[model samples]
Target: MTPQNPNLARELSLLLALATLWGSSYTFIKIGVETIPPVTLIAARTLIAGAILLAVLRHRQVRLPSDRQTWRRFFLQACLNSVIPFTLIAWAEQSVDAGLAVILNSATPIFTFLLTVLITRHEQATTRKLFGVIAGLAGICLVIGVEAIGGLGESLMAQLAIIAATICYAGAAIFGKNFRGLDPAVPAAGSLISGAVILLPVSLVVDRPWELSPSAASILALLALSAFSTALAFAIYFRLVQTLGSVGTTSQAYLRVPIGVAIGIVFLGERLSSTAWIGLACVIAGVAAMTMPRRSEYRAAQSAGNR
Candidate 1:
């Protein structure tokens, strides 16, 4: 649950609202994919979201950043956040249940922590952080359990795909944190637009959305997926990043888990074992523990105050 605050409640409310928006999207995706192919669904979603963002940016005349360096940064950000993870998750969700897919996605921060340690020397991993990750991973394992007794059954590859997606999400998070100094809107728009350009042709070659039967409901769902979930989601996410630094902003992951579980139960009628419930609690606690400011950070703050 999002904690209440006087000044920050509005933002907390908005973050929770975004979580809900994303939470409900899994159901929409499940429905859309019934009649539509994953490639078509994703292509339509990405392009539509890109078009909407382009229109908004144009209306506001928010001149796109033209510097070569900014363009490079934008390109990498798009690859990490959209092109890679989006495709992996879209395909993975097709094989795995939505609830389980989200459980896997929650590993994004753990991957992010590992990636940051490798890529950024200053953001060294701490003992508590390391312990927290291990605990969180144990919690995830408990939720998924040692189902390996059942061979590649049907979803072995699918589960692996979701894990890959989480890894992509980790890379994206680190990329995002690195780009925090730039205009959030610039990279936000760039990512969608570039991603669409990258995926459009691939989608056509594979699913050929043109040949697929088109109907009003499917079209509307695709639109909502793009407009609300992809486009607006990024906009709100970037805003949160601007308002709250990386650590504070990522608190949304903890919130998204329960919301996803609730959505799964309400819409998909998915069941969660009591063990899974306990695992979920552990996951949240572990994440909270990992991300909370260390005593050293607070002590440094106090020293600055004294100075």
Candidate 2:
């Protein structure tokens, strides 16, 4: 379907809501990690989200795939989308500033574009998509500023980890196409369960949560992150992928930058420079250019004028 199709409005709304949910997650992670270990934090996040989704599945009567192959694909998707990326981002946030981390993670669309073009070949890399990717990256750089790069040498590993998480996210977006026939909520719940199962033993061995005491604030943050960000956010995400395609769904990365910055400013008392404001403008423009459908009539009109 074309981007300008009637469904695009609903998709864009869902995209914005998903962005807001995920954009706030960096702040939640930053708070949660101050006391909670990364592995334990991730385990808790996925398990809690998984449990809630499980309840929803039963309530809605959504049947999960009993077939081993589908379950196996679900596990791989869990690792790529949730288990690895979530853990990496949590670990990386232990050192990296939340704003900077958000900026780095915004590279997801670029990775998504490349993977779609090279590996999955699920979506054609149209000129609009290519330009949107470049413009989105430029907007992120402008939003965050070059000064943020000065600290990269100090947090090189952490920064790289976040970048790696973005790569995994890109891969997950493409790989998720395998579940097209399944209910979105089914995979969303199943993947979280898979991630939790994978991380549970590791967290137990490494963090030993029995010995660790977290603040009430940290506990609340973890709950919010799991409920809103992971559970609800991902359900919407998979639905978007089925409808909008990978490029369109991954385009939420661009929206996340601005939304993340705004959350920081409003809640964290962080400041945005004038350049950052300009960058937000660029992000809006880029998203419009990329996602807005090219009408056949408009293309024909332009062709006739050129001829």
Candidate 3:
């Protein structure tokens, strides 16, 4: 398929990196929280990520959302994109597997596409995009296997919480679309700060972090989560969106699972059932079909124009 833009290949590469890096986050969070309380981990993650990004943006002479209105927009974006989803996923991880959580989180694109159309008159869904969405979910079903139903079992509440995480992701996608015109660093910094604002208070109240002493290793891991996984990764992502458009860049989630699963296996010693592998294939196929450019068609049109 022909890419929509000349720089699409480069954007895809960046998106791939973004996906792989983010995939590692599930493992990092899991390990870090072992030594630190989950709420406190999230709160620390947000603040550190926010501070580093804001400082770097300032160093680069990049101006962010200066006005109250823009800050508010960023605030809402953070709530949907980072704060809410991060909190839900962190909380849900206590009960769910990393692979299961990410597989479910992969629903973001489908929800993003639908939310885009419902929210914006211009971002209407096309047949290809719709099919991709349907096939993608079907793929997830295959990878996880029907056995997941039995595992999810009577713990319907936990399953619902994971689904709720995806819903938050969908909301974030819609909110992120509005960031098209802003500087990538602007929203990156702003949303993180917003996340910190909300998470800190809640974490302090619930975790009562003063009562629990976290180890140095967990603190280091949390720093990596903020620096490599959260802040830097987001910069690469928003930059890709600028080059490839949000729809194109968002497709990166397809690649995230394999990398995430592999990381889980190697670092966390995760073992997925055979049914889950098949499900993974389905998810990958659907996302690939949706994201790949129709190069043959673009070439034919180019030839016709030459004639």
TM-score of 1: 0.80
Off by over 4 Å in 2: 1-6, 296-307
User: lDDT for model 3, on a 0 to 1 scale?
Assistant: 0.73
In TM-score terms, which candidate is top? 2
Which residue runs of candidate 3 sit more than 4 Å off their true CA positions?
1-4, 273-284, 293-307
Q: In angstroms, give how far residue 151 of model 1 lies from its true place.
A: 9.2
Model 2, 1-307: lDDT tens digits are 2322345567789988998999999999999999999999999999999999998999998878899998898799999999999999999999988889999898888898888788777676889888888888888888877877667787789999999999999999888877887888988998999999999999999999999999999999999999999999989988888867777788888889989988888877877767987898788767766666667734654465566
lDDT of 3 by residue, 1-307 (tens): 1224444455567777888888888887776777787778888888999999989988999877678888898789788767777777777777777877777777777766776667653453667777777777776666555565457664566567767877776666555656777778778888889889988998889988888877887777788888988998877876665554455556667677767877887987876667667767766676666665567644654566566
Q: Candidates' lDDT values, in order? A: 0.67, 0.86, 0.73
Superposed model 1: Cα runs more than 4 Å off: 1-18, 59-61, 134-153, 214-217, 239-251, 275-280, 294-307
- Model 2 scores a C-alpha lDDT of 0.86
Q: How high is each candidate's TM-score?
A: 0.80, 0.93, 0.86
Model 2, residue 159: distance off in Å is 0.7
> Once model 2 is optimally superposed onto the true structure by TM-score, how far is the C-alpha of residue 98 displaced, in angstroms?
0.1
Residue 275 local lDDT, model 1: 75
Residue 33 in model 3: lDDT: 75
